[model samples]
Target: MYKQLLITGGAGFIGSNFVAHWLAQHPHTQVTILDLLTYAGNMANLQSVADNPNLSFVRGDIGDKALVSSLFAEKDFDCVVHFAAESHVDRSIEEPDIFLKTNVLGTHNLLECAKQHWLYPGAKPRTHLFHHVSTDEVFGSLQPGESPFTEENNYKPNSPYSASKAASDHLVRAYHNTYQLNTSICHCCNAFGPHQHTEKLIPKTIHAILSNKTIPVYGDGLQIRDWMYVHHTVEAIERIITKGEKGEAYNVGYNQEKTNMTLIGETCSLMDKLFADNTQLQRQFPEATKAAEGKSKELISHVEDRLGHDRRYAINANKLSAHLNFSQTGSFEENLLDTIRWFIQQHTKVSTIDI
Candidate 1:
């Protein structure tokens, strides 16, 4: 078991969720988080596990080679669950260099540090693991009728964000094959859950509806994304750390596909339903006038499509399932309902605190 872990970006959406899950399931395990706390990285995401005796936090950048090396020298982590990256597609387009520097250079720095500390420290067998938390976008887009991406899929990343991730993926593979550095990668599909940044589609939809702001969609809104709850993705991460093979990559998926338009419509409808059924929701989110009136969809404004936007993304989880006996956590609607409630709960907290 990986009793000592270095979880980079643990203050972000998926990483933070994984940390809380890890600490709960393995109360004896010690975890140190390294995060830059960028706009998307929120300290509140770790609130649930902030007081965990086995958890620690360090504010820093992964690209800082010196800092990362110093950390490895100080601690003998059994595993490194790397989640830090510049992940926003649009933002990557606007500033591709940032993506390259973080996703590519940062990942390399972490890998070099891990290899130095683990294998050479004792010339030990590969018991130590460097688990790279990656994205399905590295496999590029799928056509309408194309098969979902598998572990064997070819590299064809479309955007700057994905290309940087692909570069990191290749670097990881090279490290494992060349140096025999113990490593694994988990490629996850689009995930949504509590504490997601508003830049993401679901959270943006919820916040837009509650704040009476315009909900913007890109182009025709026909792009499809396979969605999974963050809880399921984190479970998959745990499985990879425990049972995954070194130098291998596993694609974690929920097989829940939904078009952008469809997802937005569903979220709008859910907001309307929640407000209608519960008078408290109406009072709590008074700015959600459109949702209370069942007109939340009216707020949707379709704009120009993003440059080189991928048409669809789907993942084949057969490898992860066959190897780890893992598939999913809950039904799509069940998870979606929980996510909506979580955001609403956050909204309530903010509003109450303001009052």
Candidate 2:
């Protein structure tokens, strides 16, 4: 088990969930979270475990070489789970420079610092693990009948966000090969759960309905994505760090594929069910009362497609399953309802507090 660990981007949705999950599973392990607190990174995400005796938080950017080096020297982390990067495609399109600087240069800085600290002269390999959390977007789009992305898939990133992540993935592989650093990479599919920022598709659709705003669907809403609960991805992370081989990359997914339009329809149906009885929703979100009457679907509106938008992304999790003996848990409907319920609870709580 890793004694001292460093988790980058720990304030973001997936990272924050991983911290809480890790602490719960291993009460003795100490975790230090370093995050830049970007727009998507919220401190409130970590509030559940804010006072955890085994967890600590630090506000910093990974692109800062000096600060990162200082942290590595001071903490001497036995393991690093890096989730820090400019992740949103839309945001990356709006600003590509920051993505390159943070995802590419920032990753390079962490690799160098880790090399100096964990791979010093006479240092033992495999004594420490550097696990990188990446995305399936790096594989670009797939055809309707094309096979899912695997570890051996060629790099064909379409957007700046994916390009940056692809660069980082290559750098990690290079370090492992050239410098003999013990590293592992997991390229995951769409991860959804609580604490996700409202900008994402799932949360965006829910929030739009609640606020009575139009639900924008890019292009034909035919873009396909494989969705997995955040918990499953984190479990894959834990397994990869503890048992995966050095320099090998694994694809993390649950084989739950759905079109954007289909997902939205499902969400609307659930909202209708939840609001059928009582005014728990109408009292808090009057505009969304239409959901109770099954009219929320009226808000859906098609819009111009994003530039260079990939048509599909799916992952072949055989490597992760075969190696780690792990399989995703839960049906899509169950997970989707759980996610919807969480959003409802959060919105209800906030609305009540504001009243």
Candidate 3:
């Protein structure tokens, strides 16, 4: 429904995917992508639509107040889909200051800028929205018998990363409540798909199996997390922006629950099957001895858990599905294989560069 849109962190995993999806779905809309190109952000993620005339890439920071305000002055953006953040839990633990700076302060910078431009005093009421893409970790770890995280759940973030996001969510809600700014917060479960950074669980596991390296599992590997396909997350964001009410938060989840061990084992099994079926795979990467021999499971390595590792994370997504009629598509097993193959293709492009 948005016309001229500003998408922060558009080169990151989910933001990049959403950019592609949005351009394809709304061909006439103009999209300006603001990214800092951090280690987790890659320019190659937008390679497919690099030539699209309607898509513009701006290398900048959300925390840069001058630049953000300048963009608002230049473009009459009807929507701001904020996806930028310092999201790695381990990295957040190591350096929480950066997380707070980017996740907390950076988000506030964008909101303040949007409020100034869209809700200016005596200005004509603009048809615009500020959609904040958040994570389910704000609800903290859920017990086995506990209900999935919903919009009504209290914020109980545990990690520095989640705490920062929790602060951002509150800010977005507060802006809506106090200043009457149109905002919607979307809390999505763990997203997995192509072009994701290798530090995440899915990509890390796939990379380990393909390279015949140790697949590290944390502390008994019983930590459960609900996985949502990246495109599904994009769809939820799109639907929320179009159909969802202002000043509301929606939890987007597929209800696909898998423990860390089970997910890794499934990846290993898929790799083994792929190698067994394709002789070229055996020849191309002879180093993948275990995966090619249907023995990738041997690479499973249990490690000590991290500080404040959540036992479980899930989202009900009933509000998203019921209100917006959002439903997940594709088979998880099939999508997992597709994701694994996409990483394999990336390896073929550059041998040493991490995907």
Clashes of each: 0, 0, 0
User: Top TM-score: which candidate number?
Assistant: 3
TM of each candidate vs. truth: 0.96, 0.96, 0.98
- Candidate number that wins on lDDT, 2 or 3: 3
How do these models rank on lDDT, best leading? Answer: 3, 1, 2
lDDT of 1 by residue, 1-355 (tens): 8878999999999999999999888899889999999997999999998888888899999989899888877778889999998899999999999999999999999999888888785675746899998999999989999999999999899999999999999999999998888889989999999978989999999999989999999999999999999999999999888888888999989888899999999998887888888887787778889988999999999999999999999999999999889977567877887898888878767544321
**Candidate that would win on lDDT:** 3
C-alpha lDDT of candidate 3 relative to the true structure: 0.92
Name the runs in model 3 displaced over 4 angstroms.
350-355
Q: For residues 1-355, what per-residue lDDT tens digits would candidate 3 score against the true structure?
A: 7899999999999999999999999999999999999998999999999999999999999999999999989988989999999999999999999999999999999999999999888989878999999999999999998989889999899999999999999999999999999999999899999989999998998788778889988899999999988888898899999899999999989999999999988988888988898887777789999987789999999999999999999989888888998887789998898898889888777454332
Candidate 1, which segments miss by more than 4 Å at Cα? Answer: 350-355
RMSD of each: 2.0, 2.0, 2.3
Error of 1 at 159 (Å): 0.6
Give per-residue CA lDDT, model 2, range 117-195, as digits (tens): 9988987664798999999999999999999999999999999999999999999999999988889999999999899
